[model samples]
Target: MSRFPLFAMAVLGLGLVFLYVPTLLVIATSFNESRLAGVWTGFSLRWYGELLNDRQFLNATANSLIVAGLSATAATALGTCAGLVLARHGRFRGRVLFLGLLATPLVLPEVIIGLSMLLVFVAAEQTLGWPAGRGIGTIVVAHATLAMTYIAYIVQARLTGLSRECEEAASDLGASPLRVLTAITLPMIAPAMGAGWLLAFVLSLDDLVIASFTSGPQSTTLPMVIFSAVRLGVSPKINALASVLVVMSAVCLGLAAWLQARRGGKVLPE
Candidate 1:
Protein backbone atom coordinates (compact mmCIF):
# COMPACT_ATOMS: atom_id res chain seq x y z
CA MET A 1 0.00 0.00 0.00
CA SER A 2 2.85 2.43 0.75
CA ARG A 3 4.46 1.54 -2.54
CA PHE A 4 1.15 2.08 -4.35
CA PRO A 5 0.75 5.52 -2.75
CA LEU A 6 4.31 6.44 -3.73
CA PHE A 7 3.66 5.30 -7.31
CA ALA A 8 0.43 7.30 -7.45
CA MET A 9 2.16 10.42 -6.17
CA ALA A 10 4.93 10.03 -8.72
CA VAL A 11 2.37 9.58 -11.48
CA LEU A 12 0.47 12.66 -10.36
CA GLY A 13 3.65 14.72 -10.22
CA LEU A 14 4.60 13.58 -13.72
CA GLY A 15 1.16 14.48 -15.02
CA LEU A 16 1.37 17.97 -13.52
CA VAL A 17 4.80 18.58 -15.04
CA PHE A 18 3.65 17.39 -18.45
CA LEU A 19 0.67 19.72 -18.38
CA TYR A 20 2.38 22.78 -16.91
CA VAL A 21 5.98 22.70 -18.16
CA PRO A 22 5.08 23.77 -21.67
CA THR A 23 3.06 26.67 -20.27
CA LEU A 24 5.92 27.65 -17.95
CA LEU A 25 8.32 27.56 -20.88
CA VAL A 26 6.01 29.80 -22.84
CA ILE A 27 5.78 32.31 -20.02
CA ALA A 28 9.53 32.27 -19.51
CA THR A 29 10.29 32.72 -23.20
CA SER A 30 7.87 35.62 -23.41
CA PHE A 31 10.40 37.63 -21.39
CA ASN A 32 13.39 36.49 -23.44
CA GLU A 33 15.19 39.19 -25.45
CA SER A 34 15.57 36.95 -28.49
CA ARG A 35 12.68 36.99 -30.92
CA LEU A 36 13.10 33.24 -31.43
CA ALA A 37 11.05 31.54 -28.70
CA GLY A 38 13.61 28.83 -27.89
CA VAL A 39 16.81 30.82 -27.25
CA TRP A 40 16.89 33.19 -24.32
CA THR A 41 19.64 35.85 -24.40
CA GLY A 42 18.25 38.12 -21.66
CA PHE A 43 14.96 39.12 -20.07
CA SER A 44 12.86 42.06 -21.20
CA LEU A 45 9.25 43.23 -20.86
CA ARG A 46 9.21 44.69 -24.39
CA TRP A 47 6.88 41.99 -25.73
CA TYR A 48 4.43 42.60 -22.91
CA GLY A 49 4.49 46.31 -23.66
CA GLU A 50 4.05 45.62 -27.35
CA LEU A 51 1.07 43.41 -26.67
CA LEU A 52 -0.51 46.11 -24.52
CA ASN A 53 -0.06 48.63 -27.33
CA ASP A 54 -1.21 46.38 -30.17
CA ARG A 55 -4.63 47.65 -31.26
CA GLN A 56 -5.64 44.44 -33.01
CA PHE A 57 -4.81 42.29 -29.98
CA LEU A 58 -6.58 44.73 -27.70
CA ASN A 59 -9.70 44.60 -29.87
CA ALA A 60 -9.60 40.81 -29.95
CA THR A 61 -9.30 40.68 -26.17
CA ALA A 62 -12.23 43.05 -25.72
CA ASN A 63 -14.35 41.03 -28.15
CA SER A 64 -13.47 37.82 -26.36
CA LEU A 65 -14.45 39.29 -22.99
CA ILE A 66 -17.79 40.50 -24.34
CA VAL A 67 -18.58 37.17 -25.97
CA ALA A 68 -17.51 35.16 -22.92
CA GLY A 69 -19.49 37.27 -20.48
CA LEU A 70 -22.67 37.21 -22.52
CA SER A 71 -22.43 33.58 -23.58
CA ALA A 72 -21.66 32.29 -20.06
CA THR A 73 -24.51 34.26 -18.52
CA ALA A 74 -27.01 33.06 -21.09
CA ALA A 75 -25.83 29.46 -20.87
CA THR A 76 -25.95 29.45 -17.08
CA ALA A 77 -29.52 30.78 -17.03
CA LEU A 78 -30.82 28.31 -19.59
CA GLY A 79 -28.95 25.37 -18.11
CA THR A 80 -30.05 26.14 -14.55
CA CYS A 81 -33.66 26.17 -15.67
CA ALA A 82 -33.26 22.93 -17.61
CA GLY A 83 -31.47 21.24 -14.71
CA LEU A 84 -34.07 22.27 -12.17
CA VAL A 85 -36.90 21.05 -14.33
CA LEU A 86 -35.20 17.75 -15.08
CA ALA A 87 -34.20 17.09 -11.48
CA ARG A 88 -37.28 18.27 -9.56
CA HIS A 89 -40.09 17.40 -11.90
CA GLY A 90 -40.77 13.78 -12.81
CA ARG A 91 -39.89 12.53 -16.25
CA PHE A 92 -41.95 14.29 -18.84
CA ARG A 93 -42.63 13.30 -22.44
CA GLY A 94 -39.52 13.59 -24.66
CA ARG A 95 -37.23 14.19 -21.65
CA VAL A 96 -34.55 11.82 -22.90
CA LEU A 97 -34.75 13.30 -26.38
CA PHE A 98 -34.45 16.80 -25.03
CA LEU A 99 -31.45 15.89 -22.86
CA GLY A 100 -29.73 14.08 -25.71
CA LEU A 101 -30.18 17.06 -27.97
CA LEU A 102 -28.88 19.42 -25.31
CA ALA A 103 -25.80 17.28 -24.73
CA THR A 104 -25.07 16.64 -28.43
CA PRO A 105 -22.88 19.72 -28.69
CA LEU A 106 -20.78 18.55 -25.74
CA VAL A 107 -19.73 15.31 -27.46
CA LEU A 108 -19.86 16.48 -31.08
CA PRO A 109 -16.75 17.60 -32.91
CA GLU A 110 -16.22 21.36 -33.02
CA VAL A 111 -15.74 21.30 -36.80
CA ILE A 112 -19.13 19.67 -37.29
CA ILE A 113 -20.91 22.00 -34.85
CA GLY A 114 -19.32 25.04 -36.52
CA LEU A 115 -20.29 23.89 -40.00
CA SER A 116 -23.86 23.14 -38.88
CA MET A 117 -24.21 26.53 -37.21
CA LEU A 118 -22.81 28.26 -40.28
CA LEU A 119 -25.31 26.46 -42.47
CA VAL A 120 -28.15 27.43 -40.14
CA PHE A 121 -27.03 31.07 -40.15
CA VAL A 122 -26.83 31.13 -43.93
CA ALA A 123 -30.29 29.61 -44.22
CA ALA A 124 -31.79 31.97 -41.68
CA GLU A 125 -30.25 35.01 -43.33
CA GLN A 126 -31.53 34.03 -46.75
CA THR A 127 -35.00 32.90 -45.69
CA LEU A 128 -36.11 34.87 -42.65
CA GLY A 129 -33.90 37.94 -43.09
CA TRP A 130 -32.91 37.54 -39.42
CA PRO A 131 -29.39 37.68 -37.92
CA ALA A 132 -28.39 39.75 -41.01
CA GLY A 133 -25.00 38.01 -41.23
CA ARG A 134 -22.56 36.07 -39.11
CA GLY A 135 -20.47 38.02 -36.61
CA ILE A 136 -20.18 38.43 -32.82
CA GLY A 137 -23.83 37.59 -32.24
CA THR A 138 -23.60 34.29 -34.09
CA ILE A 139 -20.36 33.41 -32.26
CA VAL A 140 -22.01 34.10 -28.88
CA VAL A 141 -24.95 31.93 -29.87
CA ALA A 142 -22.66 29.06 -30.85
CA HIS A 143 -20.67 29.39 -27.64
CA ALA A 144 -23.83 29.53 -25.55
CA THR A 145 -25.04 26.29 -27.11
CA LEU A 146 -21.90 24.41 -26.08
CA ALA A 147 -21.56 26.16 -22.73
CA MET A 148 -25.19 25.36 -21.83
CA THR A 149 -24.43 21.64 -22.01
CA TYR A 150 -21.56 22.03 -19.52
CA ILE A 151 -23.71 24.14 -17.22
CA ALA A 152 -26.57 21.66 -17.41
CA TYR A 153 -24.29 18.76 -16.54
CA ILE A 154 -22.86 20.55 -13.50
CA VAL A 155 -26.23 21.77 -12.27
CA GLN A 156 -27.78 18.34 -12.73
CA ALA A 157 -25.01 16.73 -10.70
CA ARG A 158 -25.52 19.21 -7.89
CA LEU A 159 -29.27 18.70 -8.01
CA THR A 160 -28.84 14.94 -7.69
CA GLY A 161 -26.83 15.46 -4.52
CA LEU A 162 -29.40 17.87 -3.08
CA SER A 163 -32.23 16.74 -0.84
CA ARG A 164 -35.81 17.40 -1.92
CA GLU A 165 -36.87 17.51 1.73
CA CYS A 166 -35.68 21.11 2.02
CA GLU A 167 -38.10 22.25 -0.65
CA GLU A 168 -40.85 20.15 0.87
CA ALA A 169 -40.24 21.69 4.27
CA ALA A 170 -40.30 25.18 2.76
CA SER A 171 -43.60 24.41 1.03
CA ASP A 172 -45.02 22.92 4.19
CA LEU A 173 -44.17 26.15 5.98
CA GLY A 174 -46.53 27.97 3.60
CA ALA A 175 -43.98 29.01 0.98
CA SER A 176 -45.34 29.09 -2.56
CA PRO A 177 -43.70 27.10 -5.34
CA LEU A 178 -41.98 30.17 -6.71
CA ARG A 179 -40.86 31.19 -3.22
CA VAL A 180 -39.53 27.73 -2.45
CA LEU A 181 -37.63 27.67 -5.70
CA THR A 182 -36.22 31.14 -5.24
CA ALA A 183 -35.32 30.78 -1.58
CA ILE A 184 -34.45 27.09 -1.27
CA THR A 185 -33.72 25.53 -4.65
CA LEU A 186 -31.84 28.45 -6.16
CA PRO A 187 -29.71 29.09 -3.09
CA MET A 188 -28.87 25.43 -2.68
CA ILE A 189 -27.69 25.14 -6.27
CA ALA A 190 -26.02 28.56 -6.57
CA PRO A 191 -22.50 27.13 -6.17
CA ALA A 192 -23.08 24.72 -9.05
CA MET A 193 -24.46 27.56 -11.12
CA GLY A 194 -21.37 29.62 -10.32
CA ALA A 195 -19.09 26.75 -11.25
CA GLY A 196 -21.03 26.25 -14.46
CA TRP A 197 -20.71 29.92 -15.34
CA LEU A 198 -16.97 29.93 -14.81
CA LEU A 199 -16.59 26.80 -16.92
CA ALA A 200 -18.68 28.40 -19.64
CA PHE A 201 -16.56 31.54 -19.51
CA VAL A 202 -13.33 29.59 -19.91
CA LEU A 203 -14.79 27.48 -22.70
CA SER A 204 -15.88 30.60 -24.57
CA LEU A 205 -12.55 32.31 -24.02
CA ASP A 206 -10.54 29.30 -25.18
CA ASP A 207 -12.74 28.49 -28.18
CA LEU A 208 -11.20 28.91 -31.61
CA VAL A 209 -12.76 26.34 -33.94
CA ILE A 210 -16.40 27.34 -33.54
CA ALA A 211 -15.59 31.03 -33.27
CA SER A 212 -13.59 30.83 -36.50
CA PHE A 213 -16.65 29.73 -38.45
CA THR A 214 -19.04 32.17 -36.84
CA SER A 215 -16.95 35.35 -36.45
CA GLY A 216 -16.58 38.03 -39.09
CA PRO A 217 -13.68 40.43 -39.66
CA GLN A 218 -14.99 42.78 -36.99
CA SER A 219 -15.30 40.19 -34.25
CA THR A 220 -12.10 38.15 -34.09
CA THR A 221 -11.72 36.69 -30.59
CA LEU A 222 -8.45 36.41 -28.68
CA PRO A 223 -8.04 32.69 -29.40
CA MET A 224 -8.54 33.32 -33.12
CA VAL A 225 -5.94 36.07 -33.09
CA ILE A 226 -3.49 33.88 -31.15
CA PHE A 227 -4.06 30.98 -33.57
CA SER A 228 -3.46 33.15 -36.60
CA ALA A 229 -0.30 34.53 -35.05
CA VAL A 230 0.94 31.04 -34.12
CA ARG A 231 0.44 29.78 -37.68
CA LEU A 232 3.12 32.26 -38.76
CA GLY A 233 5.46 30.79 -36.12
CA VAL A 234 5.82 30.90 -32.35
CA SER A 235 6.47 34.43 -31.11
CA PRO A 236 7.20 35.86 -27.69
CA LYS A 237 4.18 38.12 -28.09
CA ILE A 238 1.90 35.15 -28.49
CA ASN A 239 3.51 33.55 -25.47
CA ALA A 240 2.86 36.64 -23.41
CA LEU A 241 -0.78 36.69 -24.46
CA ALA A 242 -1.17 32.98 -23.75
CA SER A 243 0.43 33.35 -20.33
CA VAL A 244 -1.97 36.14 -19.46
CA LEU A 245 -4.92 34.00 -20.50
CA VAL A 246 -3.67 31.02 -18.50
CA VAL A 247 -3.32 33.14 -15.39
CA MET A 248 -6.80 34.61 -15.83
CA SER A 249 -8.31 31.13 -16.26
CA ALA A 250 -6.48 29.81 -13.22
CA VAL A 251 -7.73 32.69 -11.11
CA CYS A 252 -11.31 32.20 -12.24
CA LEU A 253 -11.20 28.45 -11.63
CA GLY A 254 -9.65 28.96 -8.20
CA LEU A 255 -12.40 31.39 -7.26
CA ALA A 256 -15.00 28.91 -8.41
CA ALA A 257 -13.42 26.13 -6.36
CA TRP A 258 -13.29 28.30 -3.26
CA LEU A 259 -16.95 29.22 -3.68
CA GLN A 260 -17.94 25.57 -4.13
CA ALA A 261 -15.97 24.53 -1.04
CA ARG A 262 -17.54 27.26 1.05
CA ARG A 263 -21.02 26.26 -0.09
CA GLY A 264 -20.38 22.58 0.53
CA GLY A 265 -19.20 23.31 4.06
CA LYS A 266 -22.34 25.27 4.73
CA VAL A 267 -24.78 22.88 3.10
CA LEU A 268 -23.53 19.52 4.39
CA PRO A 269 -24.82 18.46 7.79
CA GLU A 270 -22.34 18.25 10.65
Candidate 2:
Protein backbone atom coordinates (compact mmCIF):
# COMPACT_ATOMS: atom_id res chain seq x y z
CA MET A 1 0.00 0.00 0.00
CA SER A 2 2.77 2.40 0.88
CA ARG A 3 4.48 1.82 -2.48
CA PHE A 4 1.54 3.42 -4.35
CA PRO A 5 1.60 7.17 -5.10
CA LEU A 6 -0.64 9.28 -2.85
CA PHE A 7 -2.30 11.19 -5.72
CA ALA A 8 -3.11 7.96 -7.60
CA MET A 9 -4.55 6.39 -4.46
CA ALA A 10 -6.70 9.45 -3.82
CA VAL A 11 -7.98 9.50 -7.40
CA LEU A 12 -8.78 5.79 -7.26
CA GLY A 13 -10.65 6.23 -3.99
CA LEU A 14 -12.65 9.12 -5.46
CA GLY A 15 -13.47 7.20 -8.60
CA LEU A 16 -14.70 4.17 -6.64
CA VAL A 17 -16.84 6.38 -4.45
CA PHE A 18 -18.24 8.17 -7.49
CA LEU A 19 -19.18 4.90 -9.10
CA TYR A 20 -20.43 2.74 -6.22
CA VAL A 21 -21.78 5.13 -3.59
CA PRO A 22 -25.00 5.79 -5.50
CA THR A 23 -25.44 2.12 -6.21
CA LEU A 24 -24.92 1.32 -2.55
CA LEU A 25 -27.49 3.95 -1.63
CA VAL A 26 -30.05 2.49 -4.01
CA ILE A 27 -29.52 -1.01 -2.68
CA ALA A 28 -29.83 0.21 0.89
CA THR A 29 -32.97 2.20 0.14
CA SER A 30 -34.66 -0.85 -1.31
CA PHE A 31 -34.66 -2.43 2.14
CA ASN A 32 -36.01 0.65 3.87
CA GLU A 33 -39.34 0.57 5.72
CA SER A 34 -40.59 3.80 4.20
CA ARG A 35 -42.36 3.85 0.85
CA LEU A 36 -40.11 6.62 -0.45
CA ALA A 37 -36.62 6.02 -1.73
CA GLY A 38 -33.65 7.33 0.33
CA VAL A 39 -35.90 7.70 3.39
CA TRP A 40 -35.29 4.87 5.75
CA THR A 41 -37.65 4.46 8.69
CA GLY A 42 -36.48 0.89 9.27
CA PHE A 43 -35.75 -2.33 7.44
CA SER A 44 -38.56 -3.95 5.45
CA LEU A 45 -39.22 -6.43 2.60
CA ARG A 46 -42.66 -5.05 1.65
CA TRP A 47 -41.45 -3.38 -1.52
CA TYR A 48 -39.92 -6.55 -2.89
CA GLY A 49 -43.19 -8.37 -2.26
CA GLU A 50 -45.07 -5.56 -3.92
CA LEU A 51 -42.77 -5.71 -6.92
CA LEU A 52 -43.48 -9.42 -7.30
CA ASN A 53 -47.19 -8.75 -7.40
CA ASP A 54 -47.18 -5.78 -9.79
CA ARG A 55 -48.75 -6.97 -13.03
CA GLN A 56 -47.49 -4.11 -15.18
CA PHE A 57 -43.99 -4.46 -13.83
CA LEU A 58 -44.02 -8.18 -14.43
CA ASN A 59 -45.30 -7.72 -17.99
CA ALA A 60 -42.59 -5.20 -18.71
CA THR A 61 -39.98 -7.55 -17.29
CA ALA A 62 -41.27 -10.37 -19.49
CA ASN A 63 -41.23 -8.16 -22.56
CA SER A 64 -37.70 -6.99 -21.80
CA LEU A 65 -36.46 -10.53 -21.24
CA ILE A 66 -38.02 -11.73 -24.48
CA VAL A 67 -36.54 -8.83 -26.41
CA ALA A 68 -33.14 -9.18 -24.79
CA GLY A 69 -32.92 -12.94 -25.31
CA LEU A 70 -34.05 -12.89 -28.94
CA SER A 71 -32.14 -9.75 -29.85
CA ALA A 72 -28.92 -10.96 -28.25
CA THR A 73 -29.10 -14.21 -30.17
CA ALA A 74 -29.77 -12.36 -33.43
CA ALA A 75 -27.01 -9.84 -32.77
CA THR A 76 -24.50 -12.53 -31.85
CA ALA A 77 -25.22 -14.40 -35.08
CA LEU A 78 -24.96 -11.31 -37.31
CA GLY A 79 -21.98 -9.84 -35.49
CA THR A 80 -20.06 -13.12 -35.43
CA CYS A 81 -20.64 -13.52 -39.17
CA ALA A 82 -19.49 -9.96 -39.78
CA GLY A 83 -16.39 -10.44 -37.63
CA LEU A 84 -15.49 -13.75 -39.31
CA VAL A 85 -15.82 -12.26 -42.77
CA LEU A 86 -13.73 -9.23 -41.92
CA ALA A 87 -11.06 -11.20 -40.10
CA ARG A 88 -10.68 -14.10 -42.56
CA HIS A 89 -11.53 -12.61 -45.95
CA GLY A 90 -8.46 -10.55 -46.80
CA ARG A 91 -8.74 -7.28 -48.75
CA PHE A 92 -12.17 -7.64 -50.26
CA ARG A 93 -13.75 -4.90 -52.37
CA GLY A 94 -15.18 -2.02 -50.29
CA ARG A 95 -13.64 -3.57 -47.17
CA VAL A 96 -13.01 -0.19 -45.60
CA LEU A 97 -16.53 0.98 -46.37
CA PHE A 98 -18.05 -2.20 -44.94
CA LEU A 99 -15.98 -1.99 -41.76
CA GLY A 100 -16.88 1.68 -41.39
CA LEU A 101 -20.59 0.85 -41.70
CA LEU A 102 -20.28 -1.88 -39.12
CA ALA A 103 -18.55 0.53 -36.71
CA THR A 104 -20.87 3.48 -37.24
CA PRO A 105 -23.57 2.39 -34.76
CA LEU A 106 -21.03 2.03 -31.92
CA VAL A 107 -20.21 5.75 -31.96
CA LEU A 108 -23.52 7.07 -33.24
CA PRO A 109 -25.90 8.63 -30.73
CA GLU A 110 -28.76 6.41 -29.55
CA VAL A 111 -31.26 9.17 -30.39
CA ILE A 112 -30.16 9.21 -34.01
CA ILE A 113 -30.30 5.43 -34.27
CA GLY A 114 -33.71 5.34 -32.67
CA LEU A 115 -35.13 8.09 -34.85
CA SER A 116 -33.77 6.58 -38.02
CA MET A 117 -35.18 3.19 -37.12
CA LEU A 118 -38.54 4.76 -36.35
CA LEU A 119 -38.60 6.40 -39.77
CA VAL A 120 -37.64 3.16 -41.49
CA PHE A 121 -40.36 1.26 -39.70
CA VAL A 122 -42.92 3.88 -40.60
CA ALA A 123 -41.86 3.81 -44.23
CA ALA A 124 -42.01 0.03 -44.36
CA GLU A 125 -45.50 0.09 -42.91
CA GLN A 126 -46.59 2.73 -45.41
CA THR A 127 -44.96 1.20 -48.46
CA LEU A 128 -45.16 -2.53 -47.87
CA GLY A 129 -48.24 -2.53 -45.64
CA TRP A 130 -46.48 -4.89 -43.29
CA PRO A 131 -45.28 -4.98 -39.63
CA ALA A 132 -48.67 -3.35 -38.86
CA GLY A 133 -47.19 -1.35 -35.96
CA ARG A 134 -44.20 -1.08 -33.69
CA GLY A 135 -44.08 -3.52 -30.78
CA ILE A 136 -41.89 -6.34 -29.48
CA GLY A 137 -40.72 -7.21 -32.99
CA THR A 138 -39.61 -3.68 -33.68
CA ILE A 139 -37.91 -3.38 -30.28
CA VAL A 140 -36.09 -6.64 -30.88
CA VAL A 141 -34.89 -5.44 -34.26
CA ALA A 142 -33.74 -2.09 -32.88
CA HIS A 143 -31.89 -3.66 -29.97
CA ALA A 144 -30.28 -6.29 -32.21
CA THR A 145 -29.03 -3.54 -34.49
CA LEU A 146 -27.53 -1.63 -31.56
CA ALA A 147 -26.04 -4.70 -29.90
CA MET A 148 -24.47 -6.18 -33.06
CA THR A 149 -21.95 -3.33 -33.34
CA TYR A 150 -20.48 -4.14 -29.92
CA ILE A 151 -20.45 -7.85 -30.65
CA ALA A 152 -18.76 -7.32 -34.04
CA TYR A 153 -16.00 -5.21 -32.45
CA ILE A 154 -15.41 -7.73 -29.67
CA VAL A 155 -15.29 -10.69 -32.07
CA GLN A 156 -13.04 -8.70 -34.41
CA ALA A 157 -10.59 -7.87 -31.63
CA ARG A 158 -10.53 -11.49 -30.51
CA LEU A 159 -9.93 -12.73 -34.04
CA THR A 160 -7.15 -10.21 -34.65
CA GLY A 161 -5.09 -11.59 -31.75
CA LEU A 162 -5.74 -15.23 -32.70
CA SER A 163 -3.20 -17.31 -34.64
CA ARG A 164 -4.51 -18.63 -37.99
CA GLU A 165 -2.35 -21.77 -37.94
CA CYS A 166 -5.25 -24.08 -37.07
CA GLU A 167 -7.38 -22.67 -39.89
CA GLU A 168 -4.50 -22.91 -42.37
CA ALA A 169 -3.76 -26.48 -41.30
CA ALA A 170 -7.40 -27.45 -41.75
CA SER A 171 -7.47 -25.89 -45.23
CA ASP A 172 -4.30 -27.80 -46.16
CA LEU A 173 -5.99 -31.04 -45.04
CA GLY A 174 -8.68 -30.33 -47.69
CA ALA A 175 -11.36 -29.12 -45.29
CA SER A 176 -13.94 -26.98 -47.06
CA PRO A 177 -14.37 -23.32 -46.08
CA LEU A 178 -17.58 -23.99 -44.17
CA ARG A 179 -16.05 -26.98 -42.35
CA VAL A 180 -12.99 -24.98 -41.32
CA LEU A 181 -15.17 -22.19 -39.95
CA THR A 182 -17.44 -24.53 -38.01
CA ALA A 183 -14.75 -26.94 -36.84
CA ILE A 184 -11.83 -24.61 -36.10
CA THR A 185 -12.59 -20.90 -36.21
CA LEU A 186 -15.77 -20.94 -34.17
CA PRO A 187 -14.32 -23.29 -31.53
CA MET A 188 -11.31 -21.00 -31.17
CA ILE A 189 -13.49 -17.93 -30.63
CA ALA A 190 -16.18 -19.57 -28.49
CA PRO A 191 -15.23 -17.55 -25.41
CA ALA A 192 -15.39 -14.32 -27.34
CA MET A 193 -18.79 -15.31 -28.71
CA GLY A 194 -20.10 -16.04 -25.23
CA ALA A 195 -18.78 -12.71 -24.02
CA GLY A 196 -20.37 -10.92 -26.94
CA TRP A 197 -23.75 -12.64 -26.40
CA LEU A 198 -23.83 -11.69 -22.74
CA LEU A 199 -22.81 -8.16 -23.60
CA ALA A 200 -25.61 -7.91 -26.16
CA PHE A 201 -28.16 -9.30 -23.67
CA VAL A 202 -27.16 -6.78 -21.00
CA LEU A 203 -27.18 -3.87 -23.43
CA SER A 204 -30.61 -4.77 -24.75
CA LEU A 205 -32.02 -5.22 -21.25
CA ASP A 206 -30.68 -1.85 -20.07
CA ASP A 207 -31.65 0.22 -23.08
CA LEU A 208 -34.13 3.06 -22.56
CA VAL A 209 -33.84 5.62 -25.36
CA ILE A 210 -34.01 3.23 -28.30
CA ALA A 211 -36.69 1.10 -26.69
CA SER A 212 -38.67 4.22 -25.95
CA PHE A 213 -38.70 5.19 -29.62
CA THR A 214 -39.22 1.76 -31.15
CA SER A 215 -41.57 0.12 -28.67
CA GLY A 216 -45.34 0.61 -28.95
CA PRO A 217 -48.31 0.37 -26.57
CA GLN A 218 -48.06 -3.43 -26.42
CA SER A 219 -44.35 -3.57 -25.73
CA THR A 220 -43.30 -1.44 -22.77
CA THR A 221 -39.92 -2.66 -21.53
CA LEU A 222 -38.63 -2.67 -17.95
CA PRO A 223 -36.49 0.43 -18.39
CA MET A 224 -39.44 2.39 -19.73
CA VAL A 225 -41.55 1.41 -16.73
CA ILE A 226 -38.71 2.34 -14.38
CA PHE A 227 -38.26 5.70 -16.09
CA SER A 228 -41.92 6.49 -15.75
CA ALA A 229 -41.84 5.57 -12.07
CA VAL A 230 -38.84 7.87 -11.52
CA ARG A 231 -40.65 10.81 -13.06
CA LEU A 232 -43.45 10.42 -10.52
CA GLY A 233 -40.89 10.12 -7.68
CA VAL A 234 -38.61 7.43 -6.41
CA SER A 235 -40.44 4.81 -4.39
CA PRO A 236 -39.33 1.65 -2.63
CA LYS A 237 -40.76 -0.33 -5.55
CA ILE A 238 -38.41 1.44 -7.94
CA ASN A 239 -35.56 0.84 -5.55
CA ALA A 240 -36.39 -2.85 -5.47
CA LEU A 241 -36.52 -3.01 -9.26
CA ALA A 242 -33.22 -1.20 -9.51
CA SER A 243 -31.68 -3.56 -6.99
CA VAL A 244 -32.79 -6.56 -9.05
CA LEU A 245 -31.29 -4.95 -12.14
CA VAL A 246 -28.02 -4.34 -10.26
CA VAL A 247 -27.85 -7.98 -9.32
CA MET A 248 -28.46 -8.99 -12.94
CA SER A 249 -25.78 -6.58 -14.19
CA ALA A 250 -23.30 -7.87 -11.59
CA VAL A 251 -23.95 -11.47 -12.65
CA CYS A 252 -23.45 -10.61 -16.31
CA LEU A 253 -20.19 -8.81 -15.46
CA GLY A 254 -18.95 -11.79 -13.44
CA LEU A 255 -19.73 -14.16 -16.29
CA ALA A 256 -17.91 -11.91 -18.77
CA ALA A 257 -14.81 -11.82 -16.52
CA TRP A 258 -14.86 -15.62 -16.22
CA LEU A 259 -15.12 -16.01 -19.99
CA GLN A 260 -12.24 -13.59 -20.54
CA ALA A 261 -10.07 -15.36 -17.99
CA ARG A 262 -10.86 -18.74 -19.50
CA ARG A 263 -10.02 -17.41 -22.96
CA GLY A 264 -6.73 -16.02 -21.68
CA GLY A 265 -5.82 -19.39 -20.15
CA LYS A 266 -6.56 -21.21 -23.40
CA VAL A 267 -4.67 -18.65 -25.52
CA LEU A 268 -1.53 -18.57 -23.37
CA PRO A 269 1.24 -21.14 -24.08
CA GLU A 270 1.58 -23.67 -21.27
TM-score winner: 2
Candidate 2 lDDT over 71-94, as tens digits, reads 999999998998788777799899
The 10 consecutive residues of candidate 1 with the worst lDDT sum are 261-270
What is the per-residue lDDT of model 1 for residues 85-157, given as tens digits with 9 covering 90 to 100? 7677788899889978987998899999999998999899999997897788999999999988877777877
User: What stretches of model 1 exceed 4 Å from their correct place?
Assistant: 1-9, 265-270
User: How many residue pairs in model 1 have overlapping backbones?
Assistant: 0
lDDT of model 2, residue 133: 96
Q: List pairs with backbone clashes in candidate 1.
A: none
lDDT of each: 0.87, 0.87
Specify the poorest-scoring 10-residue window by lDDT in model 2: 261-270
